[model samples]
Target: MKTQTAFPANNLMGVSQPDLKGNGQGGIFNKAVKLFTVAEKENGSLIDQLSGMRASLDKLQMNVFIADKDLNLIYMNEIAYSTLKAIEPEIQKAFGLRVDDLLGGSIHRFHKDPQAVEVILRNPSSLPHQAELEFGNVVLRSSINGIFDTQGQPLGYVVNG
Candidate 1:
C-alpha cells in the first residue's frame, strides 16, 4: 500500500518539495530553513574566530595540538609539528602511524583504550585533565581541556604538551 505524507513525493523526481503556502507542512519547512540559515551564519563566525586563534597558536614556543569533537586531529602548532617530526621514526615504530598523517586523523590512534579516552574527552567536566603518554622511549605530559563556543557548546579540545 502507498503511504501519504504532509509533503507528497514528486513521483518523477522522487523528492518532496513542500508547498510554502498551502499545508501545515509549510510552517515546519519554513522553520527548518530558518534554523539552518542561522546555523550557517554562526558557523561562519566560528571559522573566523578559529583563524585568528590559529595565528596566535602558531607563535607559541610549546607544542600545542587541537582535535575536533569527533576526536579527529585538526590543528597542530609549528612547535608541535616540528617536535613530532623529530620523533617520527620512533612514533612509527610504536604506533605504526606517520607524522604526516597526524592532521585530519583520529586521535584514537594514539590511545590504548580509545573508548575510555573518548568518554573523558566528551565530558567537559572531565577535562582540564593531565596525563602522561608514552610513545616508544619518550614520555610526554599533556594538559587537555575542552574548547567551547560562546553558547557553551563543545567545539573540540586543545592539548598542550
Candidate 2:
C-alpha cells in the first residue's frame, strides 16, 4: 500500500499551486518565477533608497566615489566632480567633468595600496578598511568595502571620504 501526505493547494503568500505533471518542471518554474518577482521588488526599493542617499552625498564637502574592480570610475557625486574640476579645470571640457571623468583614468593615483585595497574589496572579511590618500595638498581619509550581492558575490568597491 502507498501512503500520501496532504500538501496545501496554495502557498502562504496566496500563490496558486503549479501542476506537478509528474516531471515537476511546472512546480520548479512557478517557484523560480515567484523568487524572481520577489527579488525584483526588493531590488527596486533598494535602488530607490540608494539613489536618494547618493544624491544626498552631493551636499557634503568631502569627496566620494565608487569604482569597479579594475579601478575604472563608476560614480561620483556633485561635490566630488566639482572638487576634481577645481583640481584640474581642463577635465570639465574634456569629459563633461562628471562622475566617471576623474584623473583621466583610474583612482590608482591616490590609493597607494592598490593590491591590499583590491583584496579588501574582493573579499571583505568583517569591517571596512581605512586608507589615506593625498590629492594635491589635500589628504583624504577613506573607508573601502566590497559591494556584494545577496549571495555574497563581490560587485565592486565603494570609497567614501
Candidate 3:
C-alpha cells in the first residue's frame, strides 16, 4: 500500500493551491495585487471629471494646465492650449502643441518670472499661488496649486488662468 502526500503533491483536500513562493504560479501573491483597485477605479474616472471641469472653466474664459512635480506638462485643456497657441503662435508651432505631444514640456517660458514658478513647484502646499505669465504680449493671471496624493504627498501641480 502506498501513502499519498499532500504537501509534496501540492494538493490539500482535493484542492490545489499554487505555490507562489517556489513555483511562481498562482498563490497568495496573485491575491495580493493592487490594493488600491477600488480607489484606482474611482481615480480613473477623474479624467472625465477634469474634462468636464475644464470645459466649464473654458466657458468662463479660463485656461487650465496641469503638470507633474517636475513641472512636466501633463494636461492642458482645449482652451488653455488654444488660447496659448493663439497668443503665442510661434512658441506653439515651435513645439507641436497637443496633449501627449506637450507632455514633459514646460510652461516656464510663458511665466513672467519663471524662477518664482519654480519656487512654488518645489514647495508642497495646497494653498494656491498666483503668478503673472506672459503669452507674447498678453499677460495671463495664473493661479497654481500643488496636487497631493492619498498620503498628502505632492503629486503634481494645477495651473488655472
**Candidate 1, residue 29: lDDT:** 34
List ranges where model 3 is wrong by over 4 Å: 1-61, 90-101, 109-116
Instruction: List TM-score per model, in order.
Output: 0.68, 0.50, 0.51
lDDT of 3 by residue, 1-161 (tens): 32322121221212233243543423322222222223334565333344434444444233556676567676775656565455455446444354335655776634567797677676666346765533334445556666555655555666665
C-alpha RMSD of candidate 1: 21.8
Error of 1 at 90 (Å): 0.9
- The C-alpha local distance difference test score for the whole of candidate 2 amounts to 0.48
lDDT of 3 at 127: 48
* TM-score of model 2 vs. true structure: 0.50
Query: Which sections of candidate 2 miss by over 4 Å?
Result: 1-62, 89-100
Error of 3 at 96 (Å): 11
- Cα-lDDT of candidate 1: 0.63
RMSD to the hidden true structure, all candidates: 21.8, 20.5, 23.9
